[model samples]
Structure formats: C-alpha cells, structure tokens
Target chain A: MAQLTLVQALNEALRHELREDPRTLVFGEDVGRLGGVFRVTDGLQEEFGERRVFDTPLAESAIVGSAIGLALAGWRPVCEIQFDGFSYPALDQVITNLAKYRGRTRGRAALPVTIRIPSGGGIGGPEHHGESPETYYAHTAGLKVVAPSGPAEGYQLLRAAIRDPDPVIFLEPKSRYWTKEEVDAAAAGRLGQARIVREGTHATLIAWGAMTARCLQAAEAAAEDGVELEVVDCRSLVPLDVDTLSASVRKTGRAVVVHEAPLTAGFGAEISARLMETIFRDLKAPVLRVTGYDIPYPAAAVEAAYLPDLDRILTAVQKVLDY
Target chain B: MPSLRPDQLKELYRLMAFTRRVDQEAVALQRQGELTAFPPLTGQEAAQVGSAYALQRQDFAFPSYREMGVAIVRGVDLVEYLRAYRGDWNGGLYDLYAHNFGPIASSVGSHALHAVGWAMGAALDGGGKAAIVYFGEGATSEGDVHEAMNFAGIFRAPVVFFVQNNQWAISVPVARQTAAPIHRKAEAYGFPGLRIDGNDVLAVHAATAEALERARAGGGPTLIEALTYRLGAHSTADDPTRYRQAAEVEPWRAQDPLLRLAAQIDDEDFTRQVVEEVEERVRDLRTRLLSAPRAEPEEMFEFVYAEPPATLAAQREELRQWHS
Candidate 1:
C-alpha cells in the first residue's frame, strides 16, 4: 500500500499506464513540462519521452478532437481538460462527434479515449475553475463518465478508464487532490461498482466524487443522533450501479441523494427517478436530494455554504425519515 | 516535375464523371422526396476528386459533408453512400481505420482538428504517410479550424489542409467568409499556402499531389485553397434564386470541371462509354438504397454505447411503450 494524495495517485496511474502500454499517450496544455496545473501528470512526459507524452497548444477542442483521432489511429490517448469549467470548449467534439462516431461506425471502430478533468468546487477558485460538469458527460451517450473521491479510486479508475474500449470522462475531485489515502495500484474496484462506506438501517446517503467525503462526514455527524447513515460512492455515473444503490436504499427504506451540481436536471434527478421506479414500493419515504442551487456556482465567500455540508445533508435525511 | 501521364488524367476524369453523376442522381432523388436533403457538389468535382486522388490508401482523409466525390474515389460503396443521404446513419460504409477515411464532418470546420490529430499520431508512429482534411472557405471562419491549423503548425504534423472556396457558405458569399484568400490563412499557422484553380481538375490534382509529397517528406502541413463555384443550390432545401442571379451562375457553368477535362479525353466513344457506365452505376446504387428497408427508430439505441447502459435501455423501452 502506498500513501498518496489524489493528485499523486492520478500521476502514478498515468505513469503506470504510459509505461505499461506503449500505445498509451498523455497530452494536454502544460502536461509535458508543467506537469499539469494540478500536477496530475507530474513526471509522465519526462519518463515517457516527448512523443509518448507531450504538450499541445492551449486549445481544448483540438486536444479532445485530436485524442479521438489518435484513438482511431491505434493510440490510446489520455487528454487532460485542465479544469472542470474549461471543458465546455470541447463539448461539441465530446458530444456531437466523438461520442457518436463509434456508434456511427456501427461498432467497426473503438475510440479508446480518456479525458481527465479536475472537477468540483470548494477550492475557492473563480467560476471557470470550479464547477461540476459531469452531468454533461453523463447525459451524452457513448461516453462513460466516472468520478473518484479518494486516492485509491483516483489511481485504479484512471488505469481502468485508459483500458476501457470507449471514450471515458474521468472527473477527478480537485477538492480532494490533497486528501491522502493508501492506494493499492493492483487492487482496482470495477468501473460502476459503488462502494458502501458505512452500513446504516436508518437512511442511505448516496453521493460521488467530491461529495462522497462530505456525505461520509454527514453520516458521522448523524450517528450522534442515533441515525445510522449509509454512504455510497458512485464511482461511475454513466453505468450507475443501480443494483448497489437499490440494495442500500431497500435496506434503509429512506435515501438522501447528494451532489455538488445544481438541483434542477442534475444527475440526482435520474437517480431519484430510477429509485422511484425500482424501489418505490419498498421505500419508507420519497427519495430526497440535497444539491447546489440552479444558478451558476457562486463565489468563494459563500461557496462553503453553497455546497451541501453536514447540516444540509441531515436536513434531507430528516425529511426522508419524517415522511 | 514531370507532366501528367495519360493514364492518370484518364483516371481523374473517370472519377470526376462518376461524382458528377452521383450528384445529379442525388438531386433528382431529393426532388422526388426520396432523401431528407442533398448538398450538391456540382462545379467543384475537380477540387474534391483531384485532391482525393492524390491520397494513397494509407493516407488518412477527413472530409466535410460535400465530399461525395472524395468518397467515390476512395472506393466507398454507392449503396452505403446513399444510405447516409437517406438519413440512415453517418456517411459512407467502410472500416474508418482500414480505409483511412473518416465520416463526413457533420459540422463544417470541426473535422480539421481531427485530421491534425490523426496526422500527429501518424507522425509519432514514424510513418511516411500523411493526412488530408477537406472543408470550404466558410469553414475557415470557425475557431476550431484555426486551432487545428495552429496545432498542426506547432507540432509539425504531416497533414494537407484542403479548402474548397466554392464562393459561398449557404447564403453568405465568399466576401463574407474572409477578406483575403483562404489559403493565405495558413500563413498565420506558419505553413506554406497555395491558391489553385479548383475548376481545373489537372491543377487541383498537381497541387494536392505536391503538398502530400512534401508532407510525407517530413515537411509540415500545407494549406491549398481551391477556388471554385457552387453551380447549384447550396442544398436540395436551399433556394439559390433567393440570393443570387442566373448571371452569376452562367459564368461558372462555362468553367465546369467535367467539360474542361473533355478536351483531354477527346475520343467521343470513350466519353460516351464512361458517361453511360457512371450513369448506370448511379441508377443501380439509388435502386438498391430505395429498395432496402428503412432504418428503425429504435435502432439508434444500439450504437449509442459500447455496452448500452441500463438507463438508456430502459429509456428505449419507455419510448417503445409510449409509442404503442
């Protein structure tokens, strides 16, 4: 077991993959010498050589678009989006073409592209630097969306995503970049396998990426009130471990969905709807949700308040239980 | 450089005739409500065919929606070609990797980036092969094209950026696309740029061949701007009469690529035989596509993911239930 931060774990995974597969490449603006803004690709270019890991012009569309082309040309390319909020410039490439090309080719092509985005808020950055745009990728079919809230997940999922035979949007929680955990590089949890952090019969608390740690904290606080809260880390948002989610919700009979993205039309709505359809009759109450506001992510002053903390999560948990 | 051989010129003419016939058939089908829409590449056959002919089977190609000429020259099946026009799927039927040709850029200028990326990959793989990407003057205005050109320039990727300045981007004329010629735009990307007579098939062929050769020889990308005219409506749904006069159209007809190549193949019997053969092939392709069963709406779900997520599968089921 290696004790590493989320960023270090990501760097390790990238280095491992680049060394393991000669076809795997790492490229983005500042990824070569600068080691990425978050240093997730630290030392990759130096070890892998310039051709295997290089830097590109500061163009998001080109970075992602070329990665797709590289994949088509038999190269497994992992492109870093720099930040979550900066990912929109490549939305058309990610959505209109790259996401649909494999299907358009009718399974004749496999675009094994992995796009790395340092996502989520609470780091006290500007609007463009901090945001949760995983919904956009999750909404776009053909692309698998995954987010890792811890160092272990950060390492394993990055490797797994690089090996995936399709395009993957790997959202790393920037807030958790400094969070240290022991990561066993060889032990990889499956892509869509949601991890159950705590076993509780009172209510199930489901969250992912940056919000999973917050959900755990909320669960810890709730334990003082005799409320045994169960926490689940939804590692992969696209495939979505519905079976795990359902089994947890079925046991607890109440659920509180949490995320950093906005409330309306967020991925939470899908989870809520799916829970309703699958475990409606078994539930003690309706699936309650605690999420960010529908407006743009606010400034640093009120960001902590804006993000769902222990109080907010407990509020939703209480509502579900009272119902 | 040596002059064009008789065989090469004849091959170019054969492809040009085939593309022109395909355009005519597509237009006729559109008129008969057989297709959703058709983007006719009438007067610009030389630009697409000649340039595409320059590419080897190993060289990658990225084409805009108006490159039926390129597709035909690349050995794409006619039925599969028309299948896309019928709104069945993305254009053409071939192993995109094996054939080294991408699906037509559904969005105009975005494919330039893809070509640059592919070329960069090709260069990294240590191949003598190069890549070619086609678009129109209107596409040059798009930011993605500029970014792609920038990347290609900086990385020194082996790619040929082929722009067919067909005088208009729908209703917007060439004047609106840019003040200077589109080829000169490549100069900003720190690469060589050339303007060629797009209506002249021989000229288009020579320029593309030279540029591709330079690329394969470790030279960076080249931008070749082929100046031509769209002698028909922008698409089947478009009305050229709404914006332009017949006087503008008449002058381009005089510069038609097919008629210019006529003098090269002056034998009446050869022209007659080739024209008849291409027309017969076009008819057969259209008949096969029309006779084929229409694509099912639910079939769209199949390719949406490598393994369809339960969410999408359930949604597909919901849509089915809602319909019935």
Candidate 2:
C-alpha cells in the first residue's frame, strides 16, 4: 500500500478493472490523451490502448446515451461527464433511459454502466465547475448513487461501482481529489455500507462527498470544546445503510445532516426524514441540517460563503448538543 | 426485381399483408377497449417490414412505439409484443436478446443513441453485425438523434438510421418538423442518405439491405428516409380528421403498401393464402393476449434492479404484507 491521492487511487482502481475485465471500457471528453481535466485518468489510454480507454465527442448526452447502448451490447462502460453541471445536458438520457432500461426490459438487461462526475466546489473555478448535483441522481429510482470522502473510499467504491450489475452514478469530490491517503488496493468492500470515520457519543455529524471531510474537521474542533462528535461517511446514498446511520444516531441521540447542495429538497432532507422515521424515540434533539443556501451556487469568489464549512457544521452540532 | 427473387417478393407481400391486418386488428382492439392505445403502421408497413426483413440473424433492431411491423418481421412474440398496448408491461414482454430487438421506446428518438451505441459495441467486437434504428420524420428534430448520427459518423459505428417519413408526428406535419428533406440531414454527418418510396416494398427492402451491407462492411452509418403518409390517426387516442383533410387521405389510399405489393404479385390465390395465414396467426395472438395472466403486484419490484436494495426490498415486503 502506498500513499496516493484520490485521483491516483481512482486511476489505480480503473486500471485494475481494465486489466481484470476485457469488456470494460473507459471514455469521456479529454479522458484519453489529456488524462482528464483533473488528471484522474492519467496514463490510462497509454496503458489500456485506445479501444479500452479512449476519448468521446464533446456531447454529454451522447457520452451517457451511447454508454447505455454499449452496456446493452454487453460492454461495461465507465463514462465521465467532465464536471457536475455538465451532467444536466445528459439528464434526459440518465433519467429516462439509463435509469429505466432494466425495468423497461424486465430484468433481461443489466447495464453495468458507471457515470463518473467530478463534483462539489472548493477549487473556486468559474460557473458550472463546482456544483453538487448528487441530489438529482439520488432521487432517481433505478440508479445507485455514491460519493467517496478520500483515497481509500474513492478506490474501493469506484471498483465496486464498476462491478455492480446496475447503473451507478459515482460522484468524485473535486475538492478532495488531491488529498492523499494510503489506499489498500486489495481491500474488499460493498456499495451500501456507511463507514463511521470517527467514534463519539455527544453528537453524530452525518455527511458524504466533500462535506464528510468538513464534518471530520468540525468533529475535531468540537472535541476541543469537550463535545466529542461522531462522523459518518455515507458512501452510498441510494441503497443507504440506514442500519449504520440509525445505530450512530441512536448512540449519540443527536444528529446533524450536512451537504454542499442547496438546503431545499436536497439529499439532506431525505437523510433527515429517514433519521426521524427510524430513530425518533432515540433522539435527544431535532436533527439539524447545515447546507448551502437555496440560491444558485454563487460566483467562485463568494462560493466559500455559500458552502457549509466547519463553522456552520460545528454550530449546528452545538445547537443539537445544547438541546 | 434484381435484388429480390419472385419467391422473396411473394414473402415480402405476405409479411406486409400480415402487418397490415394485425395493425388493423390492433386498432380495432383499441376501439373495443381491449388495448389502451396503439400507434398503427397503416401506411408505413413496407418501410417497417422491408427494413426489418433485411437484418441478418446477428443484426439488432431498435424500434419506436409504432414499429409493430418491425416487431413482426423480427419474429417477436405477437402476444408478448401486444402487452405494452394492453398496459400489462412497461415495454413489451418479448425477450430482447433472443429476438435481436430492443424494447419499444415511447420517448421519441431517444433510442437512436442506443442503436448507435450498440453498433459501436458491435464494431468494437470486430463483428459483421450491424444495428438498425427506426423512427419517424419528426424524430429528426430531437437532439439525441443528431448526436446519435454524429457519433456514428465519427466512430464509424455500424448502424442504419431508418426514418419512416410517415409525414406526421401526431398532428405536426413533415414541413413543420424540418426545413429540408430528412435524408439530406445525413450529408452534414459525412454519410450517404437515400430517399425512397416507402410504399414500394421491393424498393424499401433493397435500400435497407444495401445499407445493412455497407454497415457490416465497415462503411460507417447510412440514413434512409422512406417517404410515406400516415394513412390513419397517429394513435387510437388521436383524431386525423382534426388535423388533416379527407382529400389528402384519399390519394395515400391508392398508394397503400399492401395494395402496391398485392398489385405486383397479381396472383389472387397467393393473396388468399397469405390472408388465411395472417388470419390464423392473428386469431392465435388474440386468444393468447386475452388469456394472458395479470402480473403479480410483487413482480413490479423485481425487475427494477438485479439486486434490489434494502429500501426497495422493504417496500416490496410492505406490499406483500398489505396483500396478506
């Protein structure tokens, strides 16, 4: 095991899958020679050859739309959508076809298609660069949505997603791509299990994707104040490990849902409602949410203010603890 | 005549006549409140059957909701194919892989991308097989169709873009759908496009067979726009009298695909034999459809995913509990 960044680990996982499965294909805009804009797919085309790993035309819908067909044709296509906001152009294909194909065909077809979208803000790039579009995917019925916090989770979850028979929307946190962690390549894991990153009893800070790191930071800060916080990294959002989430919330008797997407109708709402439904009697206080404002993901300059940081998470944690 | 033998011409006549009769029966079924709705291929029989007939055993066909003739040609179970109109299933109940046909796509023009993608896969697998996608003239207006064509061109994917220009997308006319002819759109994608008389079974079959051959030979994609008229209402739910004139319908009646094929064959005994065979098959289809069992409620949750998640499982269990 070596210390590798999330992007590097993802590359390793992709390489492993490519070596293992001849039917697996990796393609997207700039994913071939350019190695992706974030360099996550660096050296893949050179290693796998253009047939297994190649570049596609700059059409998001076609990338996903063709991936669906490729999947139907018995190829496991792992496609990328360039960025989070760019996924909207392919939403029709994703929501209408990819998500419904299996149900449409009545289990006759299994689309092992993994759509990778570099998600969340923190790089302070221009508009449409750093939006969190996970909620749209999570709400979709026939899709499995997952987000990794760091290197190890990134590598393992991506591998699992590729192996999964159903379609998976793998949201890679752009902000956390450069963060390094030692990833065990042989480590085995499943898709719907949540990992408790930190153990505590004062309160549980539930989050996924980039916000999980922020929650860990908040937990660290809250510990200084003599209030130990538990942090749960919800790896898979769709087939939610409600047992893990409820167990953590039940132990703490308090919960704070966190995400970077807007507060209204976000995935946090679903988590908050689930917690309320499952562990209502075990709660010490009402579950609070720390999320981005309902407004559009603002200009890059003001993005830091829009995104939920340590201060916002800690404050929400403090409110739940105080109650 | 050069491409098709006399026997093959007789077979084409039989298939077109079969499709025309089945289509008429389906419309009647809808009128009798058996089927929820059906988009009749009343005028586009030759275009659907001829192109579908040209597909080799290894080749696949992606069809829109209206291509029941394609389904018939592809040898899909007629009872199973009618399940979608019966509102008994999402798509039809046919085995897609076995028949080498995809599910009926109600979302117009979306399956074009799937066809191209499948063709790309076939090409990548280094096979001689090709994929054919059927849509109407109006489907050209969709962005996915344009993207499918563009991708097919760039990748040299083995696909046939078969557009049955049946003149109407519901109430919208061909003129409203595009400025130029539908086949000319292929020129921009760096491929040859053919415009043929959709009512002529022999012409439709030859064009599709040639296009399929080119595709299988790695000649990239071809677009064939078969010009015809929507001789009836778009669907059982639609009314042609509201949008079109009777005068316009009168001329297309003379150019009916089945009538044209029958005139070409010109054998009264042959036509009677084809009609008898079609009637027997339709009778069997009606019996099977009427007798088909209603799907279990729990089955609704089964096919959504290969491994249904815990939440979906729980919901399924809850449905069972409610029933119990």
Candidate 3:
C-alpha cells in the first residue's frame, strides 16, 4: 500500500488499463502533451505513446460520440470531458446516442465507454469548471454512474469502469484529487457496492463524491452533541448501494442523504425515497436530506454557500435525531 | 465520367429498379394501413443506392431515415427490416453488423458522428475498411455533423460524409438550410468536397467510389453533396402541396435516375425480370410480416442488458405482473 493523490491513483488506473489492453485509448482536450487541463492524464502520452493516449480537438460531442463508434469497432475508449459543466456540450451524445446504443442494437452490441468528468465545487473555479452532474447521468438507463471519495476508490472504480460491458460515467471528485490516502492500486472494487466508512447507531449519514469526506467530518462533529452517526460512502450512484443504505438505515432508524447538487430532484431525493419506500417502518424519523440550494451554480465568491458542507450535514443529522 | 462495365451497369440499373419498386410498395403499404409511415425515396434512389454500392463488403455505412434503398441494395433481410416500420422495433432492421450497416438513425445528422467514429475504429484496424454516413441537406445545420466532419478530418478517419441534398427538409427548402454551397463547407473542416448530379446514377457511383477509395487509402474524410430532388412527400404522413408548386416539380420528371438508365440500356426482358423479382420480394416481406409472432412483453426485458441490472429486472417484473 502507498499514499497517492486521487489524480495519481487515477493515472495509475489508466496506466494499468493501457498496459493491459491495446484496445484501450485515452483522448480529450489537452490530454496528450499538455497532459489534460487538470493534469490527471499527466505523462500518459509519454508513457503509452501518442496513438493510445492522445489529445482530441475541443469537441465534446465528437469525443463522446466517436467512443461509441470505437466501441462498435471493438476498441475500448476512455474519453475525458475536461470539466463538469463543459460536459453539457456532449450531453446530447450521452443522453440521445450513448444511452440508446444498447437498446438500439437489441443486446447485440455493448458500448464499453468510460466518460471521466472532474466535478464538484470546493477549490473555487470558474463557472463551467465546477458542477455536479452525477444525477443527470445516474438517471440515464444504460449508464452506470460512480464517484470516488478518495484516492483508493479512484484507482479501483476507474479500473472497473474500463472493464465493464456497459457505459460508465466515472465522476471524479476534483476537490479530493489531492487528498492523499493509502491505496492498493491492484484492487478493482465491484461497482454499486457501498462502503460504510464509519459505523454508529443513532443516525446514518450517507453521501458520495465530494460530500463523503464532509459526511465523515459531520459524523465526528455529531458525536460531540451526544449523537452517533453511521457514515456510508455511496460510491456507485446508478446501480446504487441500496442494500447497504437500507441496512444502515434499518440499524440506525434515522438517515440523512448529502450531496453537492440541489435539493429538489437531486440524487439524494432518490435515495431518501427508496429508504422511505423499502424500510419506512424501521425509520425513527423522516429521511432528511442536506443538499445545495436550487440555484444556478454561483460564481467562485459565493460558491461555498452553494455547496453542502459539514455544518449543513450535521444540522440535518441533529434534525433527524431530534425526531 | 468513370465508365461502368456491362454487368456493373446492369447491376446499378437493377438496384435502382428494385429501390423504385420497394419505394412504391412501401408507399402503397402505408396507404393500405399495413405500415404506419414511410419516407419514400422516389427521386433520391440513385443517391442512396450508388453510394452504398461503392463500399467494400466489410466497410460500414450509417444511414438516415430515408436510406431504405441502401438497406435493400445491401441485401438486409426485408422481413426483419419492415419490422421497424411495422412498429415492432424502434431501430430499423436487425443484424446491422452482419450486413456491415449501422442502424437507420431517426434523429437528423446524429448518425454522422457514429459513422465517423466507426470509420476511426476501422482505420485503427488498418485494413482499408472505410465507413459512410448518409444525411440530408437539413442535417448540416446540426452541430454534431460539423463535429463529426471535424473529428474525421483531424484523425484521418476513413469515412465518407454523403449528403443527399434532396431539395427539402420537409417543409423547409434548401434555400433556407444554408447560405453557401453545401459541398464547400468541407473546406472549413480541412477536407476535399465534391458536388455531383445525384440523380445521375453513374456520377453518384463514380464520386462515391472515389471518396471511399481515398478514405481506404487513409486520405481522411471527404464530403459528397449529391444534388438530387425529392419527388414525393417527405413521408406518407406529409402533404407537400402546401409548401411547393406542382409546376416546379414537373421538370424533374425527365431527370429521374431510373429513366436516365432506361435510355442507356436497351434490355426490355432484363427490366421485366427485375420487376418480377422485386414483386416476389415484396410479397415475401408481406407474408413474413403477417406470419411473424408478435414480440412478447417479456422480450423487452431480455434485450435491455447483457445481464439485466437489479432495478431493470424488478421493473420488468412489475410490468409483467401488471400485464397479467
């Protein structure tokens, strides 16, 4: 085990996939010599040569759309869509084309496309740089959505996404890119399995992507107020760790879903509704949700208020515990 | 003009005749309520058939909605092909890969990206296997088409962007579609562009063959704007008299691709045989479509995924129980 940053672990995962399969390719805007805008693909072009790891023109639709074609041609393409908000330009390809391929071909063809998006707002970036778009993808039928909270999951999830027979939207939490953690680079975690980061009894705090770390901090903060909380890192959003989440809620009898996106129609709502439906009888309180307000992703100055934080998560926990 | 051999010329005539017959039969079927709707390729048959005929057996082609002619020429199973228009399947035909064809995309200009992408993959395999994507003049307005050409040009992907400028995108005419010549737009994407008389089967074949060759040789993508006219309503559901004048279309009668071929070839018996064959094929399609068992409700769940996800399976059960 070694302590590597999230980007380093992702790089290692990509490096492993490239070395293992010649059909695997890495391409996006500034991915080659520039090593990507975020440098997640740093030294990839040098390490694997230009043919396998290369830069593409600044066209997200073509990047995502062509990967679909490449998959049909028996090649595994890992396309990077630069940033979260920028991925909107390619959403047409994602929603209309990528999601329809399997259904269109009637199970005859499988598109093994891994679309990597660096998302969430914490480091204070421009308008289009930081946005949480996981819900939009998770709602899509043919796509499997996963977000890593730390370096280890980053390494494991990206690798697994590459090997899956279906399309996977690997949402990389940009805030956690530098958060160093011990990682077994070889460990390819199964998709849709939740990891209970910390176990408690009074309440369950569930979060994914950038909010997972904050949720853990909130659990610690809640302990000071005589409240013990279970922190579940929801790694996979689409196939969802519903079983683990329901079990945790069944144990604690109180659950709070946290996310950086808006409150209404957020992925948190889906989780809360599921918990209410399946394990409502076990709940000591109504499932509470701590989420960003419904507003346009504000500029860098007011971005903090726009995203869910530790205090917000703790407040939701206290509210659920009081019930 | 690149001259066609005796057999090649005869084959070209046969494909056009077959396409024409199929167009007539499908329109007739739509009229008789056997089919829901169909986009007739009456005047644009040569544009579809010639370009599709140019591809190598392994080379892939992506077609827009009106490419029934291309599908017919490729020998895609007619019964399975009609299942799509029969409202049984969302995608047109089955076993697209076996015929070296992509699904007939309904969305405008979308399949261009798929074509360019498949072409890139074929190029990587390094065998001279090229790809062709067919779209209408209206589709050029879509951003994905521009991006598709851009990608194909930059990567030197082996693809032919065949634009059948068939005068109208439903009610909107070519004049409203673009300000400049359609073919010249390829220059912006750094590729060679050509405009051909799409109604002329020989010219369409020659231009398409040349582009496919250059693509196979790794010369990058080429844009071919086949200037043809749509002789019928956009679909059986459309009424064209509202937007266009009958007088305006009267002149294209002499320019019909099939009529031009009939003037070149003097084999009356061959034409009669081809008409007979097409009639037989249409009859066979009708019989199969009628006899085929309706897709079971459970069949929807089976093909959704290689191994169905938990939610999907659960939902399928919900549907099955609800139906029961």
Top candidate when judged by lDDT against the true structure: 2
Candidate 3: regions farther than 4 A off: none
Instruction: List TM-score per model, in order.
Output: 0.97, 0.99, 0.98
Best by DockQ: 2
Candidate 1 — which residues are off by over 4 angstroms? B315-324
Candidate 1 chain A: worst-modelled 10 consecutive residues by lDDT: A185-194
Order by TM-score, highest first: 2, 3, 1
Badly placed stretches (over 4 Å) of model 2 are: none
| Clash pairs (backbone) in predicted model 2 | none
Cα deviation of A200, candidate 1, in Å? 0.7
In order, what DockQ does each candidate have? 0.71, 0.86, 0.72
**Highest TM-score among the candidates is held by which one?**
2
Comparing 2 with 3 on DockQ, the higher-scoring candidate is 2
Count of backbone collisions within predicted model 1 = 0
2 against 3, candidate with superior lDDT: 2
lDDT of 3 at B67: 90
- Fnat of all models, as shown: 0.70, 0.77, 0.60
Q: After superposition, how far is residue A178 of candidate 2 from its true place, in Å?
A: 0.6
